[model samples]
Target: MNKVLLIIQREYLTRVRKRSFIVMIFVVPLLIFAMGAIIALVAKDSDKLSSEQVVNVVDESNIFSDKFHDVKNIKFKPVKASLEQLQVAAKTNESLLILSIPADYDKKNVVKVFSKKKPSLLITDEIGRQMNDIAVNNSMLQHHIDPVIVKSIKSNIAVNAVELTDTGAKDANVGPNMAVGIACAILIYISLFIYGAQVMRGVIEEKTSRIIEVIISSVKPFQLMLGKIIGVGLVGLTQFGAWIILSVISTKIAGEAFNSPQGSMMGALAVLQTIPFGYILGCFLFYFLSGYLLYSALFAAVGSAVDSETETQQFMFPITLPLFFTYILSVSVLFRAPDSALAVWLSIIPFTSPVAMMVRIPFGVPGWQLALSMFMMVAGFLFTTWVAARIYRVGVLMYGKKASFKELGKWFFYKE
Candidate 1:
């Protein structure tokens, strides 16, 4: 136990003292802020960034002669020139498009569009909508019906979701919940890969340099593997803790800079208050640690069996496939139907529970299901650690031989 503690101390200090680690701890939050700033700037100035496009219309139908109007980045002008002339003009003007409405447009309900380049969906859709509205209004007039009456009959509805709890009923912030769920799942998915790979790389480095040979004389392979995993896992937790603190400080500073009664800060805080951040944070920490432990053990085993980083690829894919699968399903399927059978099973399965369960947490998972998932995660971690220790005990001493799946199986079953 003392030796494992010493190993853990050594591993943690060695990484935490590195310049790269310190740089990343501070740089990541700044990068996130910069990205947000860039997106906001672009959104605020989108109209200035986009050039207006001109559309030359040849409306032989004559119904839309004076109806075409200019919108944000598009201008419509009725032209007497034929389609061939418009096409010729469009070839010289890259920002110009030609729209042709045949005399029989009412029958075919189709209009031909030509451009030097493929037009944007926004422009095309706007044009289609305007033309359709005109055609519909014309038909209504022919039938002696008023378009205003039809427009007045249209309705827009807004729905407010309310969740019922044992205490009472409260408003549910569905958008924020979905965002938080997806964000937590993605963070866990990324952390598992980042920290797990760190363990494998650290093991491979020590083995390749023959440092493991000297260390093994004092400590068993299992102790060393466990210490390395825990040490690296702590490093991940530290980084995440730092990120949360820094993000909060940054957000507070920004909010103060733009503070007002009706400002975004107040609105954001109101939205955040409705979310169960404490519960979500607790689940995230549990799953992140459990998932890291479960995957890092396998990563350490892979490191032991391989001589170099390149050799780890063959074993990494199968280990990582479940993470990818669950992440995709969590975003696409689980968010929409958190109570679905497939989601329930995915959240309970040890291999996928980390991401799957995090995605379901914000949507309010049942207590029994959450407990069962947590239990399975612990079991999965223990099972993988035991198997990895068996492989690690033999593979650290192996050298100059390429390990295959069959070789790894033999190592796993080797006698003490």
Candidate 2:
């Protein structure tokens, strides 16, 4: 145990002291802040930056004669020219579009748009909305019904989601919950690959350089593998913790500098307060460590089987496929249907549970499901570690010959 701890300390200190690691720890947060500031400034001046577009209308029906109004950078003008003439004219005018409404527009409710280039969806949608409103209002007037009454009856309802707990009902912030859930899942996904790859690379480097032979003389293969995985995981935790602190500080500074209205800031704060960040953070740490352990053990096995990084490619895909699949499912399906059968199954499976469960957590996973997922994750890592140790003990000393799946199976079954 003490030997394992010593290996862990050596591995942790060796990488964290490197210049590149230190540089990235401080530089990434600054770069992210700078990019955000630049985007905000550009968005604040987008209207001024955009050129005005002219839409010439040739309405044969004349119903929309006075209804067309200018909005944003788009100007609508009523014109008498034929459709062909405007189409020809539009070729030379890059910012000009022609909207031709047929004589039977009310009956057909179809309008043709021609432009030198394809018109944006925003312009098309706006024009369609206006035309639909005009047709509806005209139809209502002809039937002696008031459009104002109909409009007044259409209410835009806002729903407040409240989750009932055994203790009491608490307000649920759906947007923030989804945002935080997806964010945590993504973070775990990236960390697993990054730190797991680091373990594999470290193992390969030691083996290739003949350093492992000397190190193996002092410690058991399982201890060396476990120590390296845990040490690198601790490094990941340290980097993540630092990034979170830096990001929070940077966000606070930016918020103060931007000087948002107090009411809006308070409203944002209220939304944030309902997100259950403590629970999410706790889950994130658990999943990150367990997932790292699970994948890194496989990574270490792959690394040991090969004498070089290039040889690792054959073994890497099988280990990485589950992580990739889970990430896609978590994004595409889990967010929309956290309680769906597919999501429930994905979250319970040990191979995918780390990412899958993290995504479902913010949406309020059942206590039983969460417990089951955690149990599976723990079991999954332990099982992988045992298998990896079996492979690692033999593979670390192997050289001059490439390894195959069949050979790895042999290695796993070899008795000590």
Q: Considering only N, C-alpha and C atoms within 3 Å, which residue pairs clash in candidate 2?
A: none
lDDT (CA) for every model shown?
A: 0.92, 0.89
Residue-wise C-alpha lDDT for candidate 1, range 72-95, written one tens digit per residue: 988998899888988988899888
Best by TM-score: 1
TM-score of 1: 0.91
**Per-prediction TM-score:** 0.91, 0.85
Query: What is the C-alpha RMSD, rounded to one decimal, of candidate 1?
Result: 2.4
lDDT by residue for model 2 (1-416), tens: 99999999998999899998898899988887788779988988988987888888899998985788788988889998888988888899878899989888866647788998889887899888888888889899999999999999999998898988898998878888998888889989988989999999999999999999999999999999999999999999989888888987876765576565675555666678777778888989999999999999999999999988888889998888887898998888889999999889989888898888888999988999999989999999999999999999999999878999999999999999
User: Which clashing pairs does model 1 show?
Assistant: none
